[model samples]
Target: MSTTTPPTHPQRAGLHRILIVGGGAGGLELATRLANTVGRRGLSEVTLVDRYPTHFWKPLLHEAASGHRDPASHHIEYAALARRHGFHFVQGELEALDRSECLATVGPILDLNGNDVLPRRLLRYDSLVLAVGSVTNFFNVPGAERYALPLENVKHAEEFRQKLLTACIRANHLREAGAALPEPTVNINVIGAGATGVELSAALRNAINLLSTYRLNSLEPERDVRVRLIEGGPRILPALDQRVSAQTHARLAGLHVDVLTATPVSEVRADSIVTVTGTELASDITVWAAGVAGPPLLKALDGVELNRQGQVLVDKTLQTLSDPRIFAFGDCAACPSSIVGVFLPPRAQVAHQQAVYLSQSFLRRLTGKRVDRFTFRDAGTVVSLGRAGALYQGDFGLGLRSLIVGGRAASGLYAFVYRRHLFALAGLTRMAIETVSQWLRARIRPSIKLH
Candidate 1:
């Protein structure tokens, strides 16, 4: 009897091309795992495509904005990592997908000098995964989109920092010369009651204070600098226990950081964010940290069932119901688990756990073994409210306040989160060396970026 090895892709002459789209948390880790098997072993050619040329853990963007992190020094360049990990890195916004034909078009790459780096190219893949992640949900508040910056990535945070500094310096100069002070200038208004909004508001306030001390002697940062966090919800960090939110509220209040819950902004402007109560919170900087929605591109894909928000709906095995040949997970995917009742919410925990599940599932497929259903382990929430410190949760759904830590201890643990991520990717030996090196570098130089 003769047996045949099935071709990976019908169009492929022989080679199997496995393309994983999006370099976000789940996508990147999945690519790495598969690369160790397929790419390193030469059974498959793995390619990771993303709009950005590098990858930064999405959770730390606020700290990057606060001058606590240097993106240039910390981010992992996708090109470098791909080369080291036995995968190909391709940078392009996904233009179109032809699932039936197993074809994808990655187009129109240009160089800094306006030369064509790579022309419109077609890729063939036997299997595909979508992990494009998500963006903030502005909820269509009047003028919000036109005015506020959203904390989408490190670039967005860096842009906000630069603009905020310029506003501060210009205002200070005008005040020193006895000119009329700029009204509604340099005040930052952040919308949303979630963790990102709360933490970013606090981080920005701290950064503004530090900026004033180092570069703006002419400006009274304490008096002139203002941060208003407006949330439609009754309290900040509503996802966490009431005690966590209350303690965070107190810490922020002690810093004179304005926290207004249940007060929704009716309008936003280039220079101010106006509340429904008719209070014009003068702001030169506004941030939309509200909520998240899936990318709109997923709706165009053939045979992929998507929710109203464009989230690819998947089964407990993390396989898309419409076509099991493709799988979508992470923030961009609505992976439903039996335990969660509804779709699993997009959190770092969700993404991390999903990656592990997907990797194992793929391994099981190759070995002809059974795949386990994904179970979301709800480990409490942690909210970092800048120098005011942090909050840790206890019990998954009981919402217990029995276990809590904040201040210096909480801050240290907050730093540990990113360290743990790096450890997972690079192993303990590499992460330990990196931790020591970063500490030494900080001691040798000024802690904050002067520019």
Candidate 2:
């Protein structure tokens, strides 16, 4: 590892050195917010570290995987964002942490061909934030890690898209040549019927329909493509209201996506999946959206307490139990919920709220004022169903009781949530311009990414 320090603005005395690791939703927003506030005011030296150079919203990965959304259009470059927001951006992975010295070790920068561009180096910090987010949890299921594709990052989504396209083309060619095939259709098995899996299934069906209509003319989408959403729970979207689940399940059925609930997958093979009931189903492609656990990198944090799910144990203030200077949030930190004996769910809303709270908390910290405990306010949940529309559940101003909404109103609300994220990051002007640009692009470009 090289001993040279990564390029950053020289730190000035009396400025609080705040280091935030992980450029996901929470980390990036916090960096942008604090950079615009305290960093701009010369009160703190804000630095954001991340493994990747660009930031893409995780909630949109499923849409990218289904080829319904183009990731390049939405990804934000850290360097450019930092320049505009007045924060130092460090491009490297956080490998280890030393609380006593208040330092973080970032791994070396590596090129695509496996050569090191820069050696591992240490970053000094007065305060540290870990928002590295979660990773796919296979739960020790046999052959799952090897056979299933995960949607943890942009690369994974693109890989799934390319493979889906290739499979469709190959199947169409076979049909056109009158060749005998082992299976009648190209089967796509999506494990777990959470928001990700359900949305992906719906998007996949829409993509297949568009592909058949435009590109793969020889193959009929209904006859040649099969999308299956398998879940272990009694119903899809088990976390949401049962009414929402029932409506979503019915809509998926109308879209011809087979929804299998209460059927846990015991094993995932290269060409098939074996259920706990000893049933084997053919699968050309499999996506694992089963569950997520805290990233394993948290283990390297010296003496930090971790729960069984590998999440960092933090108090209401979002500070680690072992170290007050070290903080964590988003999906990586297990913060207590309002309900007794339960922790907050790993949702984007939780992360966004924590980020907003942290920005204010930091401002208060600079003034030597009391830092407020973070509280989560549920804005509700919306699941996209592509062109078929969307389903929304949660308090929609109906006195805290959940309201179920469907069709265009629900779809518009679903879109507004994403726009809100953009608004938070880029402000009103840029967000509005971007929204209009994307709308215009949709008119000119194909509904699905062709290449």
Q: Which number leads on TM-score?
A: 2
Model 1 spans with C-alpha error above 4 angstroms: 1-16, 38-43, 112-115, 179-185, 337-341, 397-402
Please list the residue runs of candidate 2 whose C-alpha ends up more than 4 Å from where it truly belongs after superposition. Answer: 1-8, 396-400
Candidate 1 residue-wise lDDT, 189-280, digit = tens: 77886888888877877777777778777777667777778888899887777888898888877766789998888998888788888888
Candidate with top lDDT is: 2
How far does residue 211 in candidate 2 sit from its true spot (Å)?
A: 0.5
Error (Å) of candidate 2 at residue 314 is 0.8
The weakest ten consecutive residues by lDDT in model 1 span 1-10
Model 2 C-alpha lDDT per residue in residues 334-425, reported as the tens digit of each score: 99998887999999999999999999999999988998799889888999999889988876554665988888999999899889889988
Q: How high is the CA lDDT of each candidate model?
A: 0.78, 0.92
For all predictions, the C-alpha RMSD in Å is 5.1, 1.5
